[model samples]
Target chain A: MKATREAYGETLVELGREHPEIVVLDADLSSSTMTSKFAKEFPERFFNFGIAEANMMGAAAGLARSGKVPFASTFAVFASGRAYDQVRQSIAYPGFNVKIAASHGGLTVGPDGASHQALEDVALMRVIPGMTVIVPADAEETRQVVRWAAAHDGPVYIRLGRSPVPDVFPQGAKIQPGKASVVKDAKGRGFGEMRPEGERDGLDADVAILANGIMVSKCLEAWEILTAEGIKSVVVDVAFVKPLDEKTLIELAERCGAFVTAEEHSVIGGLGGAVTEFLSENRPCPVVRVGVRDRFGQSGTPEELLVEYGLTPGHVAEAARKAVRLKWAV
Target chain B: MCREVRKNVLIMIGTAGSGHPGGSLSCVEIISTLYFGVMRVKPEDPNWPDRDRFVLSKGHAAPTLYAVLAEKGFFSKDLLPTLRKFGSPLQGHPDAKKTPGVEVSTGSLGQGLSMAVGMALAGKLDRKTYRVWALLGDGECQEGQVWEAAMAASHYKLDNLAAFIDFNGLQIDGRVEEIMNPSPLADKWRAFGWRVLEVDGHDVEALLEAASYASESLGAPTAIIARTVKGKGVSFMEGQREWHGKAPKGEELSRALQEVAKS
Candidate 1:
């Protein structure tokens, strides 16, 4: 079965049940954000602020003052840009325990167009002091990240996509905050130590594919095609975007020789830009970013836009091959 | 107590050379009535967690709050002379960190009510009985965030919270309506799900009655809209928008003091 970002809502409700201090806040998009499940079970703990995102941010800060861990939900655009000042002063400046659970992140919020799609939310939120930015790969990873955000301190921004994709991690996989999970290897044949049977680990490769959100599944698919063409590629699921697993990135840069970053956000300040900033100082390598260029996306189906913007599995494979060839040319 | 507070407010605003005398004098009786008669506070133990929380959301009128605090013995009465002066605890606006009795730092408009909501929610969660009160300027209602906070307070059923709207009929730019109409204000607040009460602001007995009603009213937030003149008691400054931010000079100060003496 395919994984969906809505699975984070199930995990969030479960976490709220376990911790009495946990509260869920929604801005009239409870069903959309999947927080309605928690609202149904915990009516008293859930707050529906009726289409006011700014007030929701302020109320979340207020809830934090009362020692309640508030998880505020809305579409990514309003959560980041609409209530930017409120989040800055009330939650970020005071360092409140508020988890901004934003769904429909990046261009994956298809058909809603540019107004709803949150392309620069990651960059805008990550720069705030004491803020934890996480972009999980799939539903299971999103669940783990949500649980981690509750256990962690200060403010956290969790980005979830609207679409469903294949599960990259097996059952019973645990997620740690500020740590990167290496889902596929490029240099070796077998998965790292904890490989499930019948799963091929693309370890022997000249370049590594670093992807986040729903793009992780695309990168894995591309890795298989690249391996078939005799161009081995390692796929790293960079779920934690803020604390970009420097150790794993450095190791991959040294081993793979080149890198390709794929995400659903703008190429200017998304996962690709973060990877470039990391590699430029520590391990300089040939890099190709496969994502939205510096332009707003119009209304279209998710698949159409992905192909139009060159964000499919085939695109990743081509980008990986081009990055490897560029490294050799250098 | 209300008369004494009015006298001090007039004196302080008269000498400060730069203070909001209109709203300050308009809210003098309400502030004095709340501080002296209603609120459960301590002069020395200002940060006592169990004490009731007061947030002056219309923070531009610091003279009213300063006068009340002085009368409550939070500080010496002599400190009133240092109002808005260099190195004075009494700045143009109320700074919670600098002043002794201030609950939250409020200078920017429309934020104090939100902080008061936070305090009330804190009391409910901690199982404390301390009530939270926020004083707002009628003109400050032009801010959208105030309505946002109002909605949350009602949705949360913060019966412990009460807000006082100083309907002094004037802001910096002429009357509130001419600047930006916020009329039918009581109806607007009622629509947002608050128990609204309208009262004569300078009437001490009526102010006490409205506060009593708020205390007894449970299961919803309360807003007491006190109607007042731009500047009360001082004949020269009364009903004048110029007095909203300007202070009386050397000769005008003596005349204002004399007017207070006669009252």
Candidate 2:
């Protein structure tokens, strides 16, 4: 039950040993961002740039241009907002080999509230052309994505969490960029989940739950609740939000036809938003987006925030039911 | 050397029909001094591993950099006419990927200094002797990122980093003092623990001396406050804020070209 940030730090140290050019920079949030582990391991490669996120971002661009893979870490809010111009102009525009591994993303940030939580980071990063945005579902996925980020030679933003999340994938589950991994598939369920007789759209899945980050665990819980009710559902872990596992999503859209897109982010421009955007373009269908609905997160426990933000198993199940019930005119 | 580059900058900007001739012409001497005399670069190999990096922080002055890099034989002289045009390597701003000699992409203000700090830090990590230079505008200093970079550069003790502030009193709105004062610039740099050097920007020799001093100074970065004139070398545009962004037109182009030709 390690936090994604802890896995990030450990993976960075591993990458540092393997790739010497990989440098770490932080804006005084090394402890929180978990780059302090890398700092302790490789003092020369780790740069603690105080609390200047903008400068840290700019310096990261320079380092990347100078034949170094730089991972600049800070809280997700500051990284995506305060230094947005720096990230856009210096890193994204130029297509530098810089990785911004931001921590404390989404409602899971808890007591820090909306001011620190970055519900819009995925949207912010995904909008930039050629910028790869990754939201790992768990610690193992975070490690895999971090490894992938180091090897992939372009600007990438990997959003991480402060709180420890449940393990979704196995020990050695390899995460490919822009590919959705189906952790749970509906196989042995009864025919109760199938669409009504003539109303059948010939889709494979009656309902699909697409989620990322801390919400993936809750999605699995919702799948269990649906399974007990004789409803067959597939839970897809969409960690990559930018390139968006487009092929997988399109296949899922063709098969499931109905989706409940859940995430610990703003419903406006997050995992839910990305799914809606993609499906509307290629394959139009009914989508129920389950996330923070146009509201700021307040100080609370991680569990309370998840429930308050409507990101629990109950919310996911409710959205799935709504999506399954919606009648889209073919 | 600077006058020669300034003449080319005038020609290029005037030919492009629209560009920042004032700010571009202001730091002609500083960029010229760095590329022609001070900076250790290879036009033959723009990506030489050990080459000193120069970032044009105030991207409005890209014409000067484009002109200087062309003069240095980094690319063909014909590319200068294509500045700001469609699909041109000589973009409106310096794009490191498109341009051969440009180290990093910079057009947005306050970002170049931070990139320089990163380069300096990289050099230190690699134990390399190459230094990083970033040229900034007086008005560009008002951006909070510049100070953020300033503090980081000093905090890291990056002696391999040198930043030049083009103290060309004018900005687009009006005089820099009128728009948003960034005065007492030298003292501000000193307080940030930089080795401050004030020099007459147009004097190529003084600029060279400042660069050399900055390269040698240890334990901290150096900030050379260069006293320059906006739209310098041209009589009508000099000290005028309107020229901060406007291009020279018809008779103005011919007159500006003629004025730039002279000492």
Candidate 3:
């Protein structure tokens, strides 16, 4: 089953019902951000700022000050770029319990073009001190991350994609902030038996594919295709981008000969950059990054943009092949 | 109370040697009138849940807020010399955590008004009659977020919120008109669905009257554009852009203190 990131809205509505302190704030695009359902149910607790992203951030900060847990909604582009200063000073600097639940993150926003697509939101937000950045892989993961964001203290930015992607993880999967989830162990035979002791550690695998958000499904599909060709691979989902799972990442990088990172954002300063910076010092590995290549996107269907920008399973498979060849050549 | 507030502002700015004296002085009467005559507040219980919220939105004018809080007995007036000193609670800006009676930390332009709206909205949700008042800078109106807040206040129908725009007409650069014009300000607020009121900022009686009217008006938020002279009551600094940010030096401090003493 596939799930759209919009499914997080259902979880948010449930969270709001369970917690009276939780408040929802949206720009005019509540429907787009999937927060309108929550708004409809709890109009008193929900605020529609109407196309004013900056004011929403400041207001959310104030709501946090008034002892309300505020979940502010907008597209990733506007949340991170349009009101970066407000988020920095009012929310992040104050260490407020404000959830910046952003939808249409990355190039997946597609047809809305580059202006609306926020390829650098993760990078920009992750750099802020005390900010927790979560990139949920699918709708189920989005729901879980949204719940964690509400429960967690301080500021959090949950990145959600606009398109629906496969549910790689089981339903009700527990997600911990700053912890990466290992969805697939490519070396495991028949998806049940554990890998031999030597390969179990991940070093024997030809390459590891690390991905977040919608790209996780793509990496999984690539893993299946690569396994048939006898190329061993390990698939790890970097659900939490900031305060990244350094322990799991270091272990994976040490065991895997090479790494290929995939995300729906720009190749520069995102999941790929985070992984590269971590591995360079802890465990050096030949890394092949697959994402938007430092260029603005144009109007097109999500599928068209994914293929045009080489973000499909086939692209991940090719990148993995390249990473393996590079590792062996070196 | 007015005399004490003016004296504190003069002393604080004189000691800091780097505070905004003009806007601070311009807002004295409004602060004095609110703290002394208008607001229903407890001097001892600064954070009494039912106490009305006051936000110094034009936070560069911290000296004025500190003076009022001190006069209201939040702290001793003798602490005025610590203004802008190392490790003092009296910073160049009003930090809610550091200062008593400061509802929100605001030094950044165009943000305090939005926070005040949130406070008012919270009051509505909590079913509290406590009102929220915000002081804004006329020069700060150039920020688009101020109008964004203005629109939201109207949309939310925050009748509990009252915003005062210190129409001092001077910023750090020069006259607001020569820098970035915010003229026809009252109509702009009206267009954004606020009940706009014009008043002489330095006239305590008029300001108190307008505050009372805003408190009584229902169905929409009120914006009182208090027209004031920059650096009011200080003859040398009055209406001068140079005095907007600079504090008085030793000789100048003595001279300004003498003028303030007469007032």
Superior by TM-score: candidate 1 or candidate 3: 3
Strongest candidate by lDDT: 2
Using TM-score, rank the candidates from best to worst.
Answer: 2, 3, 1
Q: How far off is residue B149 in model 2, in Å?
A: 1.2
Worst 10 residues of 1 chain A by lDDT: A186-195
lDDT of 2 by residue, A9-105 (tens): 9999999999999999998999999999999999989988888899999999999988899999999999999899999999999999999999999
Better of 2 and 3 by DockQ: 2
Per-residue CA lDDT of model 3 for A208-302, tens digit only, reads 88999999988888988998899989888898888789988877777786999999988988899989998888788889999999888888998
TM-score of each: 0.78, 0.96, 0.91
Q: Per-residue lDDT for A147 in model 1?
A: 86
User: A169 in model 3: Cα distance from truth in Å?
Assistant: 1.2
Residues B31-94 of candidate 2 have per-residue lDDT tens digits of 9889888888999999998999998999989999988898899999988889888999988888
The TM-score, computed over Cα atoms with residue i paired to residue i, of candidate 2 is 0.96
Fnat values, one per model, are 0.34, 0.91, 0.44
**Tens-digit per-residue lDDT, A114-155, candidate 1:** 888888888788778778888888777787788889998889
Order of the predicted models by DockQ, top scorer first = 2, 3, 1
